[model samples]
Target chain A: MKRILFAFIVVLVSVSFAKNASAQSEEELVQICGMIAKDATFLKDFRIKLDAGDPPPVQRVPVILKKDVKYRFSVCNSKDFEGKVVLQLFDNNRMLATTYVIATGKDYPTIDWVCTKTGAYHLFFSFRDGKAGLAVGLLSMVEMM
Target chain B: MSRRLLYILLVLVVTASVSSCKSCSNSDDLSQDLVVPDSIAFNDPVPVLGETVIEEMMQNIASPVETAALIKGLKVPFNKDFLLTTKASEKFNTSFEKSLALGIYGCDLGYLNMYEKSSFVIDYIQVIKRLADDIQVGQFFDFSTLKRLATNNENLDSLVTISQQSFSRIDNYLRESNRPMLSAVIVAGLWVEGSYLTTRVAQVSNHKRIRETLGEQKTILIFLLKVLKVYEKDPSMAKFLTDIEKVKALYDDVKITYEVGEPEMVEEDGVIVFKQTDKQIVEMSDETYQKIIDSIQKLRADLTKF
Candidate 1:
């Protein structure tokens, strides 16, 4: 009887902590969404949350990009999240642009791409080092060429 | 008493396992509520467009602000005559009508912001707020802040950013709430108004870029039609489907071929930038372009009518 009672108490405490953690992550994302450049028009935002494990899980978002348009992609990580974000733009199976450079082990907060082809494009978001994190990716139109 | 405690333990364990996974599925299962047919009852589940496809189509719809900015760049004069009157907002009785009008006003707001027409923006914003409220998505719009930004010329950029963000929030909320049908309608409204503005501008200006941009709508139209078809089970959607399909038929002749080129990557300002090398070639004769323009104009007219 005592063992069952202890297990129930443990479960209750875990649920409480989990709920608070999720809420804080959301609040962190909302607070940092205003970091777009002055000349750019905010188009959309993609919010991602992944569990920590080997080979961080990726979230894919499909978007249409027009030819001759300059677009900016920026990402913000939650303050409590240990993992940094890696945002990549892809054309079908071909990876086009990414925020993380594997050679130098560096990550950028933003990427600027000038699209020459008008079609469906995908955005893949994940974290470095297989770490659990919460992040938001912002897509903005920088210019039209 | 011991057996009761064990039962409680099992229930608690199951509850904790289910509730503790904070990062689970991101999308709600909207197919059952949204895609079910009203005319006939079926024991087996009916397969329809997945929520992810709907989301992609939603995100892919071109923003009105981008088109308006292009018009501004082209030095085209801001013509208030092209805008739908705010009075039309009151005429929309159904959720479909109100949502579509909400999208139209959203585009018009974008145009007003792009042209820096501060005087006419407040009226549109007010109507948008009313329409959004009717659809239960008005909470996304921060009216006081938007009005404050609209009234000040120095805050035009901020006004544009906030307004666009508000629409994005509404889109997210609708998808999350299993109301993607309304969300799809809203985007259709935005696209129609945007295409109308472009075609109208194309009539007078000999701008090659504008014509190319207008021609590219062929692809977007196909995507929009596909998304709308998934929601055709709704009684209110038949008229919308018909009108949009007519527009799609008109876009059939628009030829958009591409030229493949070598992709380039360069480091600019310490950032790795990849410039897409393939070029899009939009080929449309004057006659085909004119037919598309007429079709779009009529469609927009029908949609805006009470």
Candidate 2:
């Protein structure tokens, strides 16, 4: 009887700890969004679709460069939806270069771009439907790598 | 009594375990609620146009008289005489120079704004590349000289280049961060300023002259409205559009005052002083001036996000 009681107490403690950890992970994702929104360099737009079943469509922003430039990007996903985001970069006319960002803990997956052409480009982010959410951070483009 | 106590203890432990299991199951729900969604639906992709083709088109579109008026409304003292003569007046000079710089900057910035918007519209409407080409040409301005001037000094050039490059970097950051809407807002903001300039120039000029020079105010307004309509669909642009509306109202008020009455004829002292309500006109001009200043400050604040 004492052994069963001891096991009960242990399980309860672990469960509480798990809940706290989950909450922390969720909070971190929100914090990432806040940080990105506050950044002065990158323009930002976000949308949330409440319904389920359909994979959320990737939002594409076209960039025109007068000169060739290199770029870097990072994306972080919530713990509940880690390993769900796929980042894609396109050069001018829909040429897809796929990059994967594996969300571990709260860290964003990062990608680098060495743009060789002076033309239009599109950046795409694909996330898992329903279970996962994403936050993009640390986007930079410069003439030099 | 012992049996009863043992049963109660077992019941308590079982109940506690069940509750804990239930809580663990609910954690997923809690986490899901807090999770940021994976993707946001964006407007369709905009068709891309070649830079050379776009440049050629803009050259064909002659400078409208409204363009000059809009430049004047910005109150940039671009004339070398105005800048040199006014140096002694620090307050006036500083204000004039800043407005001028911003006006120039705004024009350069308008290129990107028009590009993104026209591209988006083209993509969504599946319009032909020629239409996109036309719109792009209509909006393009040659900034080669300005870029050279801004970057003339080695030290200043590096700084200016850095600042301009930062825009692209920041744009990349937003894209990576799953906040394309914010970027879109920034782009839309540039368009709003451009549209405002177009509208201001069109309305402030004499109707007959404007019609002769730049077609009509209605045509310009329609073009601007189309741009605004595309931006209005995005959630992030709501505040920006509101700001644009405020400026538009001020412009309308200025127009109403200017067109309210018939031209009055007044004779003064010895000269045939046509009863021109010049004073009233000046006051109205001052009001419009204040509105422009307020709008610039508001725009700067909105742009701080980028």
Candidate 3:
């Protein structure tokens, strides 16, 4: 009887704590996504949640990019894991731009690329050191001057 | 009682407690008895539109900002008559109509916000909430917060952003969570209404940019039709598909050709950027443009009315 009671208590407490933790993290990511989009004129980001684990999977979003349009892509994650995730833009196997670099100390937070060719392009994202985190990718047009 | 009998009693108590707690939470979510469809039968999974097609299609949306900016630049008078009526809110009783109406009013909300018409914004917010509530996605919108924002003209940008975010969040949830039928219907509502608003403006203004902007909706409609086709098995969706097919046929002859231009390096907000130079030329004759406008107007009027 005592063993069952103890097991029930543990399970109840674990579920409660897990629920709160998940809610807080999800809430924080949503706030960050809104902040990133506030000033963007054209690009609206699709807020996505990712977890870090072994055999890290990159968050890949594929879309068609039109020729002769300047698209600006920016990312903002939870402060706990800022500068810890890398975001890359790809066309087929060709790497277009990314947010992080080693030994260069140049982490471009937002990547601005002009699609010179009209075709399919990909935005790939993954966390460094398998650190699970929440992130938002914002896309917009460079103002026509 | 025997030990086994006592154990069974304990298990029953625990299960009953958990079930009661879940019901309590569900009730607390919304006071209104929303007909949120719990069992939407589907024959197949929502097909993925070949890599990032959704993401690309999202960006390809006919932004009210562009439409509003052009209308402002042209100094066109704001026409309230062009908007859908509030009385139509009660007509959306089913999940299909409710979801589609939410998107339908979403276009009006954007158009009203962009034109800086603050007075009537809250009315539409209420309609959106009622429709969203009917669809059971009311949780995505903070109604009181949106109502407050709509009343203040200063928050027009925030209002637009919040509403857009709300729609985006719902779209992302439905698509990623494998509920693409609802997503498709909502998107179709938004497009039909948005294109309707743009075409309404184009009818009165001879500006090439507005006409060109409205013409570009052909691309968006093509993508939207592609998404809806995935859910063609649904009976209501089957009916909706026929309407969309009519719009596509009307847009069939409108040609949009892009000419490649060199990338230009420019500095914006102290950051150097490469701007794409390719310009789109929409070869739309007066008759084609007029037909497109007439088709969209008729389609939207019918959809919003019935």
Candidate 4:
């Protein structure tokens, strides 16, 4: 009787521990260049990518978008680089957006936009004239719940 | 032997049943305690993202040209006469010099930023010169005229009323219209930048000896506050207003604290010592620094809000 009771207690405790661990592991941090909406609106995200000038290192940020939603795009730099990072979003070889982000070293910042058309879009981050920095990131979109 | 085995089995069954029942009851009680507030529903989508409404509201209220004109016209007097003649003035002047230098630096960057991004062609240097002239002459001030215009003269009882109206219009437009997000973001950036300038000016005034002689800071604050008040009525403007309020509250606290002291002199080592409390100045500077950071963050967020 004592053996059966001890085994049941062990099984319950292990089950609860597994449940908690799985719950925690599922919550992951995702950085994305933009989010897509149900209406096919695209938002572009910007980040400063450090490149050593070879094949171009690219960081992919996860983006979630619904099938039909309106979206826009914006860009920002870390506070230390205020007045340093200049981001431009382009669509099909045309300039869609540009901004000179001034960061004051105390806030988490990102640019925002609504996606209007649904397809692959390219976003480019470059240093302004007389400024130098490397940028590498892929602009991806996902479905939002 | 058979009777003993049955008794043990029965005991085990009872214990298991009672434990499971207790667990079920506890779960039920927890569910009962989970009351949702009226303001928020489980089905209602959380505001993880939305259009940059604040930026849109600011743009709807006025164009950049109109805003620049308003800013230029709102100039207030910056004079030595208003300072604690010996100590406070000297310190104030020193700080003012540093601030002016910083302003110039920011202006330089601003001009560059504008030049790079703005499709509208305007001579920024010329505008800066005009701004300087307005500052020195102390006529055709931006804030004063803005207050006047906003109030519609005697028809409006107070600047606050005009602000409220303007805020409502912009706010409504943000909610009701499908405007370009970039436009809204740009407007918001300009507003935040303008507010930062105003707040910094106020910090300078807090150290001044004369309360009546309106410093650059107070003029900007009143002007910006009025503009902000106009936006408060709209939901989108309301968010921006919250940010402005945070900055304003900090400014007010510093202003009140600084005003409490009387300008007094102390003699030390054969030289008459005149001072405004260093503690106050430092505190005010710190607050200004923090507010600047907050403003920058808001500005960055605003830029993205399209």
On TM-score, the leading prediction is 1
TM-score of 2: 0.31
Candidates 1 and 4 compared: the better one by DockQ is 1
lDDT of 3 by residue, B1-306 (tens): 456755765675576567656754554334234443654434445455544555444433444444454566677788888888878888876677887888788878777877878788889989988877666577777777778886656666677667766676666656654555687788778778877877878878887767776677776676677677877777778888887788789777888787756555555665546555556677767888888888888888777776
lDDT tens digits by residue: candidate 4, B1-306:
755755666565566566655554554122233333342221323222133333222212212222222222344333222111112112212211222222222232232322232221123223322332222211211334333433343322222222222222322232333322212322344444444333444444442321211212232344445534543544544665675566556455334212222223343433222222211221245545555546544543342233
lDDT of 2 at A10: 72
Q: Residue by residue across A1-82, what tens digits does model 3's lDDT show? A: 7677666666666655544443335445555644553455543564555676777657777665544355667767766553
lDDT of 2: 0.36
Stretches of candidate 2 exceeding 4 Å from the true structure: A1-8, A23-69, A76-84, A91-93, A100-109, A114-121, A127-138, A143-145, B1-227, B230-306
CA error at residue B119 for candidate 1, angstroms: 0.9
lDDT of 2 at B149: 34
Restricted to chain B, the TM-score per model reads: 0.82, 0.30, 0.80, 0.27
DockQ of 3: 0.26
Interface DockQ of each model: 0.40, 0.03, 0.26, 0.01
Interface RMSD of 2: 22.7
Q: What is the lDDT of residue A62 in candidate 2?
A: 44
Indicate whether candidate 3 or candidate 4 has the larger DockQ: 3
lDDT of 3 at A69: 52
Worst lDDT run of 10 residues, candidate 1 chain B, spans: B24-33
Interface RMSD of each: 5.3, 22.7, 6.1, 20.9
